[model samples]
Target: MWERQDFVLLLDLDAFAPKDRVDAFHLALNDTSVPNDVVHESPEKGIRARFETWRVGSLDLFDVRSTGFEVRRTARHVRRHRERPVVSVSLQTMGVHRAENAGERYVLGPDDIAIFHELTPRLYGWSGEAASWAVTIDMEDLGVPVDTVTRASVRLRTSPVHDLVLAHLRTLRRDPGGLEKDPGAAALGTATTDLVRALLTSAAHDAEDRRVRAVMNDSLTQRIMAYTRCHLTDPELSPDRIAHAHAISRRRLYAVLGRAGIRLEQWVISERLEAACRLLTSPRHAGLPVSAVAARCGFTSPSHFTRRFRAAYGVTPREWRRHRIQESSRTPPDGPPDTIPPTA
Candidate 1:
């Protein structure tokens, strides 16, 4: 029914007669940004199909619950529709399913995740009350190498990060409100995208050369940055601890960070100092002591925080706060004109 609309769709084939199921399902699949041909072996009793889908930024979430059937995305369909290159991730929640693309077949059982290219010729088949939560991400916005993505689609074995991605996706599917709005939604989308990229890159590491490993290293760097950003307040946020948390050696972690021009120790200190600076400058935090801000930002010693803060910003924390407050007071009611800070 919503063939032309590009937003959200909730389709239930059970509401339609058997003769109309094909058309209804076709439109629903198209509405969810996947156009395919659905085939059934025989006319049977109670052919049920339901899809609940919504868009979260550039990503689309689809929850499908249906009976036994096969869906095909053929070369002809690809030519006629001219779909964009997208990465499709399926989190199988119930039963088993098979996906074939680029002459490779992958079987995904319960609690499994499979990756595929949306524009490629593919086939999907499942029996019984098969169901899954699927998400399609735009390839261009993925910020990872396209070749690795193509290789990863062939087959991806599950890992800790892969399982985390599945659990997070289940949360997203259950309550999408956290990803449908602004501000927080952007972070949510970015987190999900990074997790997916990390999962794919890690899975693609087998039989890879140095070039491909470099791409995978970039993904690892991103995941490490995300992990560090969230744990900056921890007193034990050292290279050893971070490396252990990610199951990578200290040497490998250093190599990965070096490739990105990031020194692990310096980066962590920089992040902590940045957080402390924000707190010092925030009006709401004006009453907070410098030592409190330092401790809150992971510095064990106030003296060390003061020395490092002065070295990085050319002023002590208290001096910087005083100067910022003076500058704010001198500005007119309209507020200081927008100025871009110089990048270090």
Candidate 2:
């Protein structure tokens, strides 16, 4: 059913008979889609929706699931889409989604986000109620240059920013009221949309192939970044070890780090410094010595890390730790976590 006021198409297919189900809602979108394709047979029960809103940034949303058909939306695998002229940033809010873009396939699930040029041949399919949430945004409006958008969209590893956007989208879904009203809704919408491009450029991590190298490198960098966070105290951590474990070359490691806006050694040092700051700030780790904490986070020389830490954070590691402890003692829970609603 299409909601005129909201410009939203809501599809609920749980009630359709198995064969009837496939026949009814398997219709592909035609307005700006690549074509001459149809669903041969539908899978079992699933839900899907696609909608658009022409507000700031031309917000568009697509939600769908239909037994994971390779249903077409393009003329061919290589042909560019002349119709859907916008680049889309998609967030997997629930269940799962599999998309083929840039000649490589991505398996994404709830909370994971990806960006792709929609004008190119792209395919999205799902099964088992594989749900997703998305917002289609135009390229030119993204503030960053097309080259920057192109660079960032495929190179950067997913960041805290992506999680923040996912949180906002899911929160709005659970509470659509705040945005349906006046300036408040508009304000929130603007803020939410602004982050979309940031996430794209950041995820693109400055890669153009946008296929295996871009995403794989980004994912590797994230895992490496995370591992560094968890083991900041271990000085043994280095690019060689990371590359060996991930089965990539040292050049590839540095390239991945480059996408994160820092090279390998610099990145490791910086991440350790950040973790040290976090540890110092938390009351739990506040009692630990600055040097010990530094060592634990892979920082060798206390003075060197301290100088860099102060430069990066505008305060010494110890000072940041103290400030954090003080802040946490008074900081209340900001709000409920934006969580996925089971079996909507």
Candidate 3:
């Protein structure tokens, strides 16, 4: 099973005695990753390894830096440790790595990426000091057939989607701590899954397959949602501009989002209202006037913004900000303030 950890688990072999470091590192792997046999290449020289992992929504993001070692997952291991199938994509950031799966073998260098499945027997290892960033996703969540994933695994470099997905993973690794605390972390995980599905669809030879086409359509919808979120502050973020930016017809965009139950205008307005609410209550934006806040949140007119904000939140923006200020004044630094009784 994929371990769900909200905090990072770091294991540095230097903290253990030379004789016990290898064993400790081995045990750490079993706890954080799949069950497998770990063998250090030169235990006599002492093992230098560091493993860190944390969860991002349903995805497991990990980083490993170690001296020469080999990890073997045999048929026996798979049978004994029966768990949900997962696919792992790893990007080699340093040194060389080798992977073998189902009789196909590949050697990867810096910036190269490889994909492997947990349900299959495999061998993965590297010599000297090597580092990599990887993410594991459940097969059910990936929404792609096992055959499709396997077919695309070896040919990922052939498609531009490969670099796009790689860049996303790099960004996740760049600031994992910040990402873990982000409210949109779950959305980011979903976006990663969608990008992987797109990469698989593009790399696989069976692009004409029915299921592949469905995955592609779903990926487009996700892309639209992500793009909209990023451009929420732009006043020109309309259906025509969004559709044109994605190179899809306005009708096609509507069809995709409509099937997903998203009304473009309503969703956009709600998002803007929420943005305005956040800015109005923030101390950093306290000096700004309500009209300025509305304008900054993509509202062309302060009157329209007030109407929508009041309709959605049951109070005017100024009242909401004043209430927040009052609440802060009543709150003590050491403890939470007593709950205010509801007014009749």
Candidate 4:
């Protein structure tokens, strides 16, 4: 009854398990953990557990990393621990347990799940020493609609669809095979994302009224912005340039960002100024003229930059630069608009 054929482990199974498949999935269940004993049993009856911590490039559209724990019933108690940048969703496939965390208690059973934001500083425990499976996903990794996080946490429900979704995700986790690059990976990634989103929405019914489409659009825009910033050193970088990079017309790009307030041009300049502010305080650029730092963000004229950066932050470029050099962290987050470089 090897539930996980990934690691080699002792599996005591009756005739029911697929002979060759059980042995393979059985071996896959061997796991290393923090003194937690995981076992492999019949594909359906015994405890079969697998887990691993995952980290990937965060700059991608799917900025997600995961830590997963899949286990059959066992007697050992799991100590509560906090995971930053993640929300822990515990699903009780076939066992029952009480989950304790952050002064809140929850009981989970078959066809049930619990949602606990591990991002909160807290502790947690599994009740009844019940064996279960849980997945720790950096909410960002799951490309969760940040705008809807408050709504989704209202409650947790179980969805059979998760069985299919989780299985596909696990397959992707192990397969390097996929689209050639971006467009390809992005397409499959999007599909994988839809299934997960559907399951999440189903569990947290509040999403029924949520703006799932708008959130996806906003997130896609963010992906475009991140891409633009990364390629800023390129002399051709501009609103049109970025739109082209994302395979959209310049007008369409602006339309996409109509919801965020301010035009695309303003957003890019704001981002550049923010980046420049941090560099303005750095030692490498401290001795250089303030104009040089402005140039780095695509400014050509010192006079124009000073007025904008100052307008944004209330201090002239040189004044802001000096303030930053002395105590950068104290520099107000809003760089004086007076110091912002003029529009290109």
List RMSD in Å for every model shown: 11.1, 12.4, 8.1, 18.4
lDDT per residue as tens, model 4, 196-310? 5555655545333455444434355554644565655454578877787657898888877786454766766676676567556555456867778778877667777677788
Q: Report how far residue 306 has shifted in candidate 3, in Å.
A: 23
Model 4 spans > 4 angstroms off: 1-218, 233-235, 327-344
Give me the runs in candidate 2 sitting further than 4 Å from their true place: 1-7, 10-28, 32-57, 71-84, 143-160, 205-344
TM-score, per-candidate, Cα-based: 0.60, 0.46, 0.66, 0.38
Backbone clashes in model 3, listed as residue pairs: none
Q: Candidate 2: TM-score?
A: 0.46
Q: What number of clashing residue pairs does each candidate have, in the order they appear?
A: 0, 20, 0, 36
- 145 Cα displacement, candidate 1 (Å): 6.4
**Alpha-carbon runs more than 4 Å astray in model 3:** 1-7, 224-247, 250-344
Q: At residue 48, give the lDDT of candidate 3.
A: 92
The C-alpha lDDT values of all candidates are 0.72, 0.54, 0.78, 0.46
Q: Give model 2's clash tally.
A: 20
Number of the candidate with higher lDDT, 3 or 4: 3
The alpha-carbon deviation from the true structure for residue 184 of candidate 1, after best TM-score superposition, in angstroms, is 1.6
Return whichever of 1 and 3 wins on TM-score: 3
- Minimum summed lDDT over a 10-residue window in model 4 is located at 58-67
Better of 1 and 3 by lDDT: 3
Clash pairs for candidate 1: none
